[model samples]
Target: MNEQIVITFGNEKILTELKAAHPDRDLMMYQALSQPGEFMLLDHSGKDSVFKAPVFYDILSHSGEDKWDGFISFSTLDLNFDQQKVFDARINKLRTNGLPDGMHSIYSLNYHKDISQRIILGTWDDYADFELWKNSSDEFIPKEYRDSPNFYSHEAYYTPAKTKKTQ
Candidate 1:
């Protein structure tokens, strides 16, 4: 039973309950049909139900194994990007600008689903280069993150999940 738990629109009961529980905290819960195990969390800090979902996420664990091999998707904008750059160059950038098989479509591996343990890390494929991704210099599939030792990366940080569930 090695399945990762996620929030879904069909869980309206949970959603409504979550919404009612933290009315003061903003929430943007929705269902994205394109990706199944996917859930949208737009600035969802105080209102992340994944922390309170079930036994699965309640004791969340992360692996730096081979399957985490996806892009850190992000929209092509300077808004959060620049701030993120200021924050650190190596943080997982999971969102996208909607291009043909682009980063926006590669959300599975880039964000943190920090569950019970309170911290999960998202590492990029070593070839991660914003300038390269946006440029027409060359088009090619990227190698694994372990390919280059010189690859720039962000220092690991701890993000505490909501240990208390209203439900």
Candidate 2:
């Protein structure tokens, strides 16, 4: 079944206000680990979801645990059909064999309004754990795959939103 996930970027104030306004909605917020003042709001409600900001995506599929703590990783990639096949295989292998330690959940989502692109979301135990997998992931992709002009990938890491108690 097709689901929808909204992505919004801003400071914590926006997220806090939105949460306060919609107390019952299941929303997950985060702050970019490397970028200050950058926050992300994730709304999984398939119905009348509210995203005040301009970023949102229609999720083709979502898997893994809904709980995310420690750190969150978001990545986007654009590839052609052949590249997608290989990409799918590699991702499937990882899922089938089990994700590496310290990685809690992994989600493969289609880019908003574009099936040719993909968005990967992962929850990690810490920055170190994410770095480890990222370094090794280069070896998993075929060398020829990198030569394709259609390949484009960008990944960012974020820490979960800090509550008033933690702040």
Count of backbone collisions within predicted model 1: 9
Q: What TM-score fits each model?
A: 0.28, 0.84
The deviation in Å at residue 88 for candidate 2 is 1.0
RMSD after Cα superposition, model 2: 2.8
lDDT of 2 by residue, 1-167 (tens): 43766777776876777766777877778888888778887776665667765465666444456556568887888878877787778777777777777888777778667877788777788889978887777634455656766567778888887744322
lDDT of the structure predicted as candidate 1: 0.32
Report the C-alpha lDDT of model 1 over 39-149, residue by residue, as the tens digit: 432222323344343322321222333212233322221113343333222223222223322222222222334311222223234224433553542222124322545
Q: Which candidate leads in lDDT?
A: 2
Please list all clashing residue pairs in model 2, or write none if there are none. none
Candidate 2 TM-score to native = 0.84
Worst 10-residue lDDT window, candidate 1: 155-164
**Predicted structure 1, TM vs. truth:** 0.28
Positional deviation of residue 166's Cα in model 1 after best superposition, in angstroms: 18
In candidate 2 the C-alpha lDDT for residue 104 amounts to 85
Q: Which runs in model 2 stand beyond 4 Å of their true positions?
A: 60-63, 139-143, 146-150, 164-167
